[model samples]
Target chain A: MLQPLRDRVLVRPSEEEKQTSGGIVLPDTARKRPQEGEVLAVGAGRVLDTGLRVPPAVKVGDTVVYSKYAAMQVSSEGEDLLLLEEDAILAVRD
Target chain B: MLQPLRDRVLVRPSEEEKQTSGGIVLPDTARKRPQEGEVLAVGAGRVLDTGLRVPPAVKVGDTVVYSKYAAMQVSSEGEDLLLLEEDAILAVRD
Candidate 1:
C-alpha cells in the first residue's frame, strides 16, 4: 500500500452509479461537479509551519466527494486510485 | 484592507515584463507557466485539524512565482489583485 504524503489522501473511486454504497443518491447536477470515492488511506496530516501536524478529517472507509479536476489518477498494485489534497475534498457522506 | 484567511495570500501581479523586480529574467519557457507577483498580504496561515495555524512562507513585499491556473482574480479598492492559496506559490525570488 502506498502512503500519501502531507495532506494528500488515497481514494478508490466508486464505479459510475446513480446511488452510492452509503445509500446517497446522486443528483444530476452533482454528476458534472464532484466525484465520489471511498477513502483507502489518508496521510498523517498536513505539517504546519510550526512543525505541528493537523490530523486528517476523513479516515479509512469514509466515503467522500472530491473535486473532479483536482484528483490525480494513479495505479497501484493494479488498482486504479485517486490522489488528491484534503482541500479538494468537498464533503463526506454520513 | 481585506485580511485573507488560512494560508491565502494576496498578490499584486507584476505587469508583463522581461525582467522581474528581483533582477531575474523570465525564461521563454516560463512565459506560459508561472506568473510573478509582489506579496501584498498573507493569511494567518492554514488552520490545522488541531486548530493550530501554519505561518505563510512569503511575506509582504516578497516577489514570488505562483501557478497561473490556481490564482483567483479579485478587485478591491479599484485595484486588481490575485488571491491564491499558499500552496499555489511556486517559489520566492530572494
Candidate 2:
C-alpha cells in the first residue's frame, strides 16, 4: 500500500481503448494512451505556496479522466498502478 | 481570448523535443509528446462538493511540468495551445 503525499494520487489506469468511435481498432503504433482510470488513493492535498490546502477533487472509487503522460508507473501488490499529480486529473465521471 | 473556467488551465505547450536526452533525433513516428509548458491562463479554482474554493496551483507565466496526453490542442492567435485540467500539472518549475 503506497500512500501518496502532497498532491499525488494513485490511479488504476483503465484498459486501452482498442476500438475507435467508429469501431475500428487502430494499429499498435497508432494507438493512443488511455485517459481514464479508477481512483485508488490520494494524497492529503496540494499545498499552495500561500499555505492553503486545496481539497482533493476525486476520492477513492471515483472514476476519473486523466492524462496519459501524467502517470508514473509503479507496481503495487502485483498490480500495475499509476502515480499522478492532482493537476493531471481532468475530471471525475459519475 | 479564450478564458478557461472551473478547474481548467491553459498552457503554451513547448516545441516537441526532436532530439532524445542523448542528443539523438527521433523520427516523427518514434517521437513522444512534450511534457512541459508555460502557463498562459488559469481557471478559477475548482469548487469542492463542500462548496469550498480550492486555490489554483499555477499562475500565468509559470513554467510547469505537464502530462503530454492530458492536453487538448487548440489554435490561439495562430499559436498552438493546450487546454488542460489543473490536475494534469505535475509541478511548477521555478
Computed on alpha carbons, the lDDT of every model, listed in order, comes to 0.71, 0.68
Compared with the true structure, what per-residue lDDT tens digits does model 1 show for residues A17-82?
223434543443232245668899999988777677887767899877565455677889997888
Residue range A54-81, candidate 2, lDDT tens digits: 7676789987756655458799999888
Best by DockQ: 2
- Model 2 misplacement above 4 A: A17-34, B1-6, B9-94
- Report the number of the highest-lDDT candidate: 1
Off by over 4 Å in 1: A17-32, B1-50, B53-94
Model 2: interface root-mean-square deviation in Å: 8.9
Work out the TM-score per prediction: 0.45, 0.48
Clashing pairs in 2: A86-B87, A87-B86, A87-B87, A87-B88, A87-B89, A88-B87, A88-B88, A89-B87
Q: Looking at model 1 chain B, report the run of 10 residues with the lowest lDDT sum.
A: B17-26
Q: What lDDT is reached at residue A22 by model 1?
A: 43
